[model samples]
Target: MGVVRAAGAQAAARLTARACRIAGRGATSLPGKVLLRLDPAAIGDLARRLPDGSIVISATNGKTTTAAMTAAILEADGRSAVHNRSGANMAGGIATTLLDARGDIGLLEVDEFWLDGVAAALKPRVTVLGNLFRDQLDRYGELEAIAQRWRVLAQSTVGQLVLNADDPAIAALGRGASSPIYFGVDDSRIGLDAAPHASDATHCGTCGTPFVYERRYLGHLGIYRCDVCATRRPAPSVVAQEVQLDGVSGSRFELVIDRTASIVELPLPGLYNVYNALGAAAAAHALGISMSTIVVGLEAVRPAFGRGESVAIAGRALKILLVKNPAGANEVLRTLSLEGGPLDLLAVLNDQIADGRDVSWIWDADFEGLAPTIGHATCAGTRAAEMALRLKYAGVAPSRITVCEDLPAALGAALDAGMGPLYAMPTYTAMLELRRELVRRGAAGDSFA
Candidate 1:
């Protein structure tokens, strides 16, 4: 943990990263792994060098996009950040980001499970806990377990806490915190008629009574209250009102902060993204960023990689929307439902470690809603047959679903079969493979690029 030893570890890690790049491999997390092996406290040591300190953002979904939005806001404010923009959020990724640091501050998107350790190390100026859903049940047990950890983090961290007031599990974390900045959507126009079957947080964390939702938004995120304990969604200082979701193009919402409002034109789709924008705005406000600057930054932000990233392949548009779990997948499907046409899809489902071995969560996702709109669907990845079967069960014609385990071949077939924009919905590893194939074909940039 000494200066000399930390310097030596960083040098070794840098050399390893150079070798990884030479060998045509991603250097995102490997070098950090090497650095940590040499110096276990390297993250803290390097993070301490940043004069402006760090900000940590974590959630089951939208952490990457939220962090990207916050990074854009920082850049608009003429500040530089050492950001893990490559969707790397674990200890290794955080260390690699610190190793390659050249900026005054750190903008880190941490994994939900790793938030505690990284927060302990970075002791960020602001810790943004976006909404958490049931993800990777094999690795991350239950939602309550992560919430308990976050509750501890909220209690122990000295930095300001930015929480989503709509999520009961997340809003409850602010109960003991001194002054948590809460953010949520104030628009009831976009709320679901009723909570979906995939909704995770149905009961109050305090009294174990079922929450009565006045209006349900994405998943369990909505305006809700508990009758037994009187626990309710916190009033958010940062709220998005009069929201307008513009399908795959993006969305617009009134960004309201402390009663003052500004129209924000966010170039990202879905109600889920609205939540992301609210969290980013709240976090930026907590850092003393002006409302005007926040609006400009939100407007300027782009899609974070596979999350709504569009690619041009052989003149046909292919939009990559990542679907990892039930809640996240439901949002993506809901967004797709907004587009006015029969959709062409390249749906890839992988049971990789990163994607979660239990692929049963696909059953919980409301694929039935989007089935009628499918023009032609190409299923690929380790679970291609299973994915195709799910689509068939969801009312997609069996003849319309083509099974191809190979990603490149499936992409080609999907392109050939579709006349319009093709939406590629892939799990974590499948998305990496799909992007790699696109990069190889000169259709897209590298993941880190």
Candidate 2:
């Protein structure tokens, strides 16, 4: 009887989704919202019907890319997974994915705030926690609050746990889990000489003492030890050693898992992406996927939407790199700095509820590092003036900064002004707006949802 009701709700949701598409609206979260209202158990009932069970991936960042990498790996291994390809990752979005699934396994990237409830409902076979950083202080309170919730979820979940060993906060979560799998970077050549100003996890979560770092990778992710508590980063079983980063093009790294090594020529840039690949590889390893298959999957995985997505329009390349929080923005800026030339940028800053009403995080990002290289910057979105002001304070010349609150006008001006590749840095809502403009201009597909 329960299965019958769940099926009926799914059918109704599908009809609603079709109606939304016909009406020219995104059916990402609305249908699932309706389904859950009709049947609260729809998520679990539909998830359990999958033959190969489910895998849950969650973090403050990189969860979507990590899930996409895992999905690609599963595809390489000849397994089909029902995944949430779009960035919609809350309960309604996840339920919508389960409703539209045509595969044997469920692969999901959940929002950090929604991970507990979503994982509880899905009862995933493998749970991957990448890393935690300060994000959306208004919505998520503090990093410690989310960490506590994750610690509880880790303690209660009766499944395989895959964790990032370099993050002190994430590494500490493996305490009571049954043999958690740890993944991290072992390449000192790629490490930063000093920690960035936007580093989040500098203190040990266990002892409340400052962590002594041997090397700092992206933000607070690196090898560290606490002198007082004797707590240190776990020796990861799955590691990325001897990494080579190539500007904005891609990266190469030696992926070592359980004493076996394979060279992965990843088509993604930056050390943050290397961490994303490691998390995905570790999760796949936990699922018994072969090393060669994982490498193939990592090599073939494409960028998820605005995270390093590029489009060619009007004889110039427009690259979209999503920047929401400090850690994420810093990484994007760092990657742009690698291009080693003057850059043309379209920066959008929105204060939508999804983007957090507080727009103070831009102050923490390392925009100064790329200031000297910024040839021309057009600031757009709801807070265009503030973004332009930020660039000016970061050492960018006032003459080089253009303030245009409208996205379409700003995009046209930025493209016309640049002789080389143009970079677009936008927050969540702003990215959607920018993509919509791109789609209308026939540069991008309407299938972003």
Prediction-by-prediction clash tally: 0, 0
The residue ranges of model 1 lying beyond 4 angstroms of the native Cα positions read none
In order, what is each prediction's RMSD in angstroms?
1.0, 1.2
What are the lDDT figures for the candidates, one per model? 0.92, 0.91
How many residue pairs of model 1 clash at the backbone? 0
Instruction: Itemize residue pairs with steric clashes in candidate 1.
Output: none
**Candidate 1 all-Cα RMSD:** 1.0
Please provide, for model 2 over 52-154, each residue's C-alpha lDDT reduced to its tens digit, 9 standing for 90 to 100.
8899999898988999899899999999999988867999999998997789899999999999988888999999999999998988898889999998999
Off by over 4 Å in 2: none
